[model samples]
Target: MSRLPAVFATGLILALAGGAAAVQRLPATPEPARLTGWPQPAEMPGFGDDGTLGPAEISDLTEYVLALAGAQRDEAAVIRAVPLYQTHCAACHGLGGEGAEILGTPDLTRRQFRVVTGPADIRLQIWHGDDGRGPMREAQRRSGRPHG
Candidate 1:
């Protein structure tokens, strides 16, 4: 009976030790880099006959824009969107979201937009340009570029 107890304890210890070793050997999940500024991409998405921005990218960019307009910021999403804004919007909206009068793009840094009232409105603008300019969606579909 005493021998049985010793065997059970030994088996428990061995099982625990084996589990610890297995845990040590397991691969760790990679952590995303700590981004202090915007992330830059090697290649920008092309405004080809098909729209370049994906659904996720548009969501991230919208969140980032809201942050720029003084809304609650999603730091991670904002960082991810920095390069996207530079490549896609900066040409007309300017780096600071100052916007261009000639291009008829509205200033994004302001809290109140002439056309955009909320997130959906911003997404609509991204998909379709403002009234002064031709619809970005149709232009991208037809010519692979925004028609200012």
Candidate 2:
């Protein structure tokens, strides 16, 4: 065989040495993956007809809704809220969660509603009865269960 060039021999040795070092540095368990956080959103479970989260849907909706809070829309919260409105709310609040005038639902016009802040306050409206026009009060009356 022809004598190898000194530069080529040196490079080959260095490459082999670097590769060996890399193999040693690599972890057998891959550092246990560190579990940076929740799995990728694309891996989320699909939302069922009832609008409940599956392993996939839970991951997806969480990502979507959280993303909306920072987005620009007529009301990103309202848009992201479609699922919630369709679920716990549509029966009394109307399809869009727009207050019902006939039932005395509180018109969501910011001008109409009083200054409000905090999630519990909003949750209270959802939990208690916003009988401004919605059937929340009636549901409470008929069900005789907690206002949910």
Candidate 3:
């Protein structure tokens, strides 16, 4: 007989016993702390009273974003987009869309895109991020880059 099996069994038993003991030590009813001098929730500046955009406002903003995507070649839009892209996307996608293979970022300069079909598709991807790939979606979400 090997000592390895006995050692493994003993370790597992000890781990289970430890977990059970810890669980048993937990309080059945947790006490809620009395509210002290914490600041009450207040309306934030620049967010209206509710901190949200209405449906119509959201729709209009989405339409405006779509228009901007469609007008990427327009001089003013290009100027605005260039800085935005550099700030938000260049870290992963590269400054010139060359992509970073080590980070699994895809090249964007290619004529044929694997994911995007049109301006709307690009906008959706920008807003939602890629699910099949890395943390692009989560990164966009954390950055809170205004999609609309």
Leading candidate by lDDT: 1
Score every model by TM-score.
Answer: 0.52, 0.30, 0.41
Q: On residues 1-148, what C-alpha lDDT tens digit does candidate 2 reach at each position?
A: 6566987999999999999999999878764443245332111111332234333323333333333334233344455556754664455445534555444444442213332343323333344434344323334355553322
83-133, model 1: which lDDT tens digit per residue? 989988897678988876544456778853654557765654555445443
- Please state every model's RMSD to the true fold in angstroms: 14.6, 18.4, 16.4
Q: Largest TM-score belongs to which candidate?
A: 1
- Candidate 1 wrongly placed segments (more than 4 Å): 1-49, 131-148
Report the CA-based lDDT of candidate 1 relative to the real structure. 0.65
Residue 3 Cα positional deviation in candidate 1, in Å, after optimal superposition: 99
- Tens digit of per-residue lDDT, candidate 3, span 48-140: 123344333333333433434343443555554565556556666677766655555556665223445455445445554455642234334
Which of the predicted structures, 2 or 3, would earn the higher lDDT when compared with the native?
Answer: 3
lDDT of 2: 0.42
- TM-score order, best first, reads 1, 3, 2
